[model samples]
Target: MKTPIIMIAMLSLSAPALAGGDMPVKTSTEVAYQDLNLATAQGQKKLSDRIDIAARRVCKLDNSITGTRIRDRDAERCYVAAKERANQQFAAVVEQHAKGG
Candidate 1:
């Protein structure tokens, strides 16, 4: 009975360490993805800048562009595109983390 009790206590003490220590640390890419996810707002802003540049080029190529209309349309498109891309990137990060990649 004493032996059994000691064995049980030892197993209980070592269980948590085994579970935690056996887990692998995140890789650099996984860490990068996590950092990007944490800074999603900043990522969105950067993506928005790229979208704005593209939309501005498009507006410039079109002769009928009114400044206000072009700005409004470009802003709307940029927001939507930025949001979609950000969401895709967020999903990729989640997948990478899940896969331990």
Candidate 2:
């Protein structure tokens, strides 16, 4: 039996793009929940927390000293989008598991 993994990613305009440059960056991280039982609310909550942390890291919103005033807003946007995407992936994984996949 293989363990399930969730992928979290942020693909945004990036700091350079916010600074009037035409470049973008993509950052990604993985959350492994093989030890978690997604069928329970507690397990789901733990996975959600992990997703939040991963999203912050992917969007560079985890460190206060690494962003500027203008970039702060964009980072927030990136974090929201990244978390949404991660949630979608999580849902899919859960559904697949329920189907015995």
Candidate 3:
């Protein structure tokens, strides 16, 4: 018998505004799916949905080392980086879940 696989996805950030700087804003979201069966389309879709939500959530707020000028690319960069990380993470774990490894 094989054990159920649990997927825990998380994103987080924190920054404190220094003197004469914008207030640092940071946010993180963690999503967990219990007994996820990535072998099925439904399971894969759910995981993808969770990752999208998490990416948007993590990049929704702007965070800067010095709270300097915030650019749109910053959010896009964050989103892309987060999505890549999620894909890598899920790639390994999802395979395990699918094959019951």
Candidate 4:
């Protein structure tokens, strides 16, 4: 039998624009953990790492040039918010898996 895939939609970037624009933009990615043995610490760490990678991609802004302190600040804020939200979801999933859900 094939292992069931557990995917976490790591983030949806509807936060304040990272480009310092009034318009809001959205980006998202899913992290899959079907192959991971969540019963082990290593597996959990890998899941967390995957979420971090996805969150970074979803929140990234081209920091090359893009002169302006406001834009830089916005980008930083976006990454923090994205990572926080993803981690929250990650915690919930881990808890659920521990309970054999």
Candidate models: Cα lDDT each: 0.37, 0.82, 0.63, 0.65
lDDT of 1 at 32: 24
Candidate 2: tens digits of C-alpha lDDT, residues 1-101 = 65588888877885667698666767788999988888888888999999998888888885675455444777789898888888998998778777877
Task: Report the CA-based lDDT of candidate 4 relative to the real structure.
Answer: 0.65
3-89 per-residue lDDT for model 4 (tens digits): 333333323334445456555555566777888888889999998888767665666644454566454455567677777777777
Task: Please give me the total number of clashing residue pairs in predicted model 1.
Answer: 0
Off by over 4 Å in 4: 1-22, 61-63, 66-71
Check candidate 1 and list the clashing pairs.
Answer: none
State the lDDT at 99 in candidate 1. 66
Which tens-of-lDDT digit does each residue in 1-101 have in candidate 1? 11100000001123444688764321111112222332356754544444344433433323344554453443355445544544565455445545655
Q: Candidate 3, residues 1-101: lDDT per residue as tens digits?
A: 43333323333332334444665555555656565567888988898888787787678634453656665565676788778877777787677765676
Which candidate ranks first by lDDT, i.e. highest?
Answer: 2
Steric clashes per prediction: 0, 0, 0, 0
Segments of candidate 1 deviating more than 4 angstroms: 1-71
Give the poorly placed runs of model 3, Cα more than 4 Å off: 1-27, 61-71
lDDT of 3: 0.63
Q: Rank the candidates by TM-score, best first.
A: 2, 4, 3, 1
Which has the better TM-score: candidate 1, or candidate 3? Answer: 3
Q: Give the least accurate 10-residue stretch of model 3, judged by summed lDDT.
A: 5-14
